[model samples]
Target: MENSIILNPEKITADLYPKKFGKAGKIWTVILIAVCAIGLFAYIRQLNKGLVVTNMRDYVSWGIYISNFVFFVAISLVGSLITAIFRLANVEWSTPLTRIAEIIAVSAIVFASIIIIVDMGRPERFMNLFIYGRLQSPIIWDVVVISTYFFISLLLLYLPLMPDLKILNQDPSKNSRFLNHLYRIGGSFWKGTKEQLKINNKAVTTLCIIIIPVAFCIHTVTSWLFATTYRPGWDSTNFGAYFVSGAFLVGAGGVITAMYVFRKAYHLDKYITDLHFEKMGRIVVMLALLYLYFNVNEYLVPAFKMKKPEEEHLKELFTGSFAPMFWFAILVGMIIPIFILIFKRGRRPLPMFIAGVMIMVGAWFKRYLIVTPTLLHPFLPMHDVPESYKHYFPSWEEWAIAAGSLAGALLIMTFFVRIYPIIPIHETINEKNEMAEKK
Candidate 1:
């Protein structure tokens, strides 16, 4: 198997090296930078005015920003899933993808932090979250878990890179000063000594054990931000599991999408192979079905009762203004992907990419559903506000900032792949050697 992978020091060096932008890559970088800049401009305007610039009011206090934050936290869980869960379970095929998952985790979690800060009405008084932070508040719980998750994810991404960084630092001819300096700073002390390996092994094991629960906590606490409220769609016993399962699904979907893009652009076909995508398709299908099952429970139980609050919410979802987005999310995000994945052809890269897009896009709407509809069905009638305030649509500033955050995450991932190996070089080689031994 090692022989079959056709390792070429030069090909690996050329293909995996931090590339100067190709035309498309350059164009993509420009577009993302432009969007982020616009988002920054809009956000500055928002800061100058207030959250008053946007459409949200007291009734819908938590709108698209909260939903988008949840999306980031949920998807960040894929890092733990691929890097920790698969590694602990000794799943060999997942080796190629560990860094992809971990990088996504790190980047997503990083911006999860940023976007939450952006969402704050009082962005300037931000230390209030800490200065007057309440331990009992789910928001505080979120702060705790997100911080812990971030460190664990950072270590998860970094520990695995030592060997590769050491390799990079040794090349005297590589003229990129920043990266060469970064490589030295990252791995100058990493001699890959037996003791260093042992310490690294132990640290990774500790993080692996620790991150699983922290991962659950991050998403669950995120759900709790809703469940703790006495709102219609959010007030349920099932919210935690439903969110966690869906988080795993979307996180898996995100990683799948990122994996395809990275594999294509970096020409890492030999490293991040087709088998990984097939297996990830199976994983996404399982998670999607699980989440859909929970969605039935989440909706049907209250739906069966036709309770006043839930009745209004469910009706809005089924037949009112929100209906199209709701059904589109359910069918496209969950049902169709599950059905398609059952066929082998559908799990191939192209169809899998299509399915990945559906899962991600649908997951966005799903997060919106989790947030807005419930707010709309507030226990108190939404009165004493303007007509437009009664029905929420994002303002242009909101859209720019939201779109910017998404662009920012993608930009981070793109820059990361350019700087570091998107696929783990040491791990992929080790897996190949192990397979050769077996053969």
Candidate 2:
């Protein structure tokens, strides 16, 4: 009842103000920062020594960095799902999750950009993509869409926060000098008048509509990055749906993970309730099945045909050296989680969290499998290259950069939660009020 719109405004405000992190939060922040620093050191070493520090060669031109990039891009789709998709569908239960999803999308996209840059050993040559880039290239399309996606995501996150910002601005006690200053800067023009509210809602609706296709474009074009290639595994028409479906699965899983963490860390159990987890669990299962369908289409058709090129590639994934990781990704990422979450009890917070972690870790390895094995099965054999070129493994520097990018994404999410209310306070209040009225 404290969160109901009928409740005293002051109490609702008290529930939503950003809280100072406790000892555990502080320690977690430190760990993330330290990991980022280590990654930075490794990047500096790479800059000094060149890509020689990594195990990459002609055969395995793409490695974990590309996989990490794919992972980031995949998880970033949550913005479209929870924010745009749910909002447009008028699913009020998702009100509390939009901000968190937007933040995750923004953070993941940020690191997606960074990891791509990291993949380009000579960062200075990045401008070549602009000056010398062809319009037909999927890479260029990716650049255009991802940049658009990031800005749109930022706007989506900011627009909903305007009312809350006005709240924080009015009460000096609610936030410190810097935060209050941010509140003023961001929401000073938002008067919450009838005209302003109408315009804001219209703008949000328009953005939600626009972002959905752009979201699909980013991952679809990303899949084209491989599919357009002549390699064995990459040469599939199903790649677009495969990548997009997997993106939704991982993005949903990431949201579930964030929901659990924020619910516990910020004592948001009142806002992000068990029912929320139940709904998200059902969503995860649906997405997992969708992804599984794509996985079957991606693999089974090729297996049935068994062309010379597809033969070795499918063998590698089915029963060869990559079998363990391949099976692990499929089983943990989709199958096991599906089975667990099929039960009502599995939709609980803890089980959902476990399933989310499994999906995420498995998805990461899935991306790795997507990029690496195909390169290993190129159209031609590696004749003159060293034995190292024949086998691909990420070097310490590569792992450091990849891990650092992941840590940095989480760090961004952590800092955002520290600064802003993870749940949309105004929206939650309105939702509770509506339910109360209905009752």
Candidate 3:
């Protein structure tokens, strides 16, 4: 008996077309807009009052904004994981996931850029980076790679949508006036000719090749921003690999979360099936284990050596004030997820979603642990500063803005789905036909 899954082309098209937002989606959108408004107000206040409105001081220069930036960068790696790596490896099951991952990547990177600007109190001075930017600086490297990655990710997203755009363009009943305009503007020329198809395929493949190294560079440069510093926790050669590994883990977790949400919201059981969750669950576990290995390497050697310079910093993470966050990140982010997904039932959609949330929340706090603790234990003793400088916590403004930025990112993704098909209708149909033929 051939146990192959088959999909009908017309049914697939009907099921996957972009639909107007339902009640739940509309409520979600309104909430996101409100949160973004709050964030905007907070930012205006920040501009008026300066960074003094926040708890960040000399000892803890980078706070929630930087942590948020790092989290965005880490989660954005899912674009490469699903679209580039899986596509290049010829994985068929990921077709439903590529667009999801790409949108997540695009949204995350967009906010990553915004968060960086948020960290810079004087936004106008951002131009100075171009005027006085030095090749020698890691910050410049980060800027270059992030810009390059964003464009490449955008193109990766747009290229795959061209064929689908043609589908939407031809079907007058499927598109609204606004969406029809968008489809025409974006893909009026995509006639699905043999030459056009060949060119598009090559373009996507070439981009897949190019983006892998650029994605690596963006995160590696980010890691360099810390590893190059003289702080005890930050000064290690293992930082790059550790950051990359953790990024992959968080990105995978993000994908799992999206998979469950889209599956439920769109009633996409036939498309994003339980098998998809199972396979993604396995990938998450593998990434969790890999990141766990790096965590051991990152912490164990330093703890074992216990050098005088690192003792206080290591102690803070292991048994001191930051110990709670550190262990939560390790256990909830990596360990518990692994244990959950290791079992057959845990790979189900509901459990996978819960595990994904844990990983993301844990990773966010992990970033805080990465940036704050190291700065707090500076090599030089603190003197002549306000006592508030010794302790660090984000003020109400910081919390509001961070929440708003996050809400805004989700809103962008939500709007994108409302406007465009979350899955690649053309690609999914093609894959279905190919699988049927093979069977």
Candidate 4:
């Protein structure tokens, strides 16, 4: 039965195949473009009026924008984790998921680059980082590493896409004249010759090897931005591990969420089955536990020590202004989902969707904790700034921009699914052939 399912490609593939966006898809695209335009306008306003428009003063300088940047980078790691790791490990079942993971990685990393620039106090001065970039500063490392990560991720996405684009180019019905021409130009050279295939495969493998270190560098540098500081919560000896684990957890949660939505919308249950969700639920649960362990180390030890600098920050999260958010993040993000996923029923699609949503929402707050709380507990007391600067809440403009970036990601994923085979048709067929030969 499994062989039959694999050998005879389901008609579902034809039905679910990447199609040009219909009216619904086009409308969705337009809405995202409009939202993004408004955000660009607001950003221009902020740039003209100075950072004063942001309500972020020196103490709370890193606000929603920076947190949003971290979220994008964290989620981008899904590409390296799921797609490259599984492919190189020769995990056959993962073929259906590689495109999804790769697209998410590419989209998130693209925006990770953008959002960090948005967070810059002097974006125009960004060239200064290049002109006068110092190896000594974590910021320079972040810029260098993130750019490398983005390119490798883009290559990882594009390399696999070559074969698929060749397939897509054959379908005169599914693309526009422009897209048809684009594919012709982009992939006309790819005839899928055995030599070409061998070379392409080797290149992907090499990139898979290289991206691991590049991915680690990007996130570790993000953590260093905090750990290098003298601030209490950010000063933790365990910051790097804590950041990496939580990053993966959130990233997996994102992939799971997107998987469920795309599976249903595209009617891909024949490919992305309950089995994938069940397996993903188990992975997410493990990551959550790992992150929870780090969370204990991150906060519990600090809470236990009650260090003079840590006191105010800990109080703020435990019983002060941030208490409700803190507990909600823990309960909704980690604890409840962990328990739910352990149950057989909970690993099913609907419950897993609920868990995915919880994890993603919690991850946002987790980034907030990583960002805002540290600023609130700056080495010096909050003074000489407007009272508004003392508190951190994303202005409507901020929310609009963040939401637009997310919408942009969805649009990219949506259009990608429309144009390319979301599940690798060629790879799936090859694997099935190999299995049949073995039999």
Q: Rank the candidates by lDDT, best first.
A: 3, 2, 1, 4
C-alpha local distance difference test of each model = 0.85, 0.91, 0.92, 0.83
Q: TM-score: which candidate is best?
A: 3
lDDT by residue (77-173, candidate 4, tens digit) is 8888887777778776777788888889888988888887887868998899999999999999999989999899889888887876777676766
Ten residues in sequence with the least summed lDDT for candidate 2: 1-10
Per-structure clash totals for the candidates = 0, 0, 0, 0
Best by lDDT: 3
Which structure is stronger by lDDT: 2 or 4? 2
TM-score against native, each model = 0.97, 0.97, 0.98, 0.95
Model 4 clashing-pair count: 0
**Regarding lDDT, does 1 or 4 come out ahead?**
1
Off by over 4 Å in 4: 1-16, 22-24
Per-residue alpha-carbon lDDT of candidate 1 for residues 174-251, written as tens digits (9 for 90 to 100):
738888787888888988789998998889888888899999999999999889988888889888999999989998
Clashes in predicted model 2: 0
Greater TM-score among 2 and 4 belongs to 2
lDDT of 2 by residue, 211-317 (tens): 99999999999999999988898898999889999999999999999999998888777778898999999999999999999999889988999999789989999
- Tens digits of lDDT, candidate 3, 1-439: 1115566878888889888889998898999999999999999999999988988999998999999999999999989999999999998889999999999999999999999999997988998988999999999999999999999999999999999988888887677788888889999999999999999999999999998999898899999999998898999999999999999999999999999999899998888888889999999999999999999999999999999989999999999999999999999999999999999999999999999999999999999999999988898868899888988999999999999989988988998998888999999888877777776
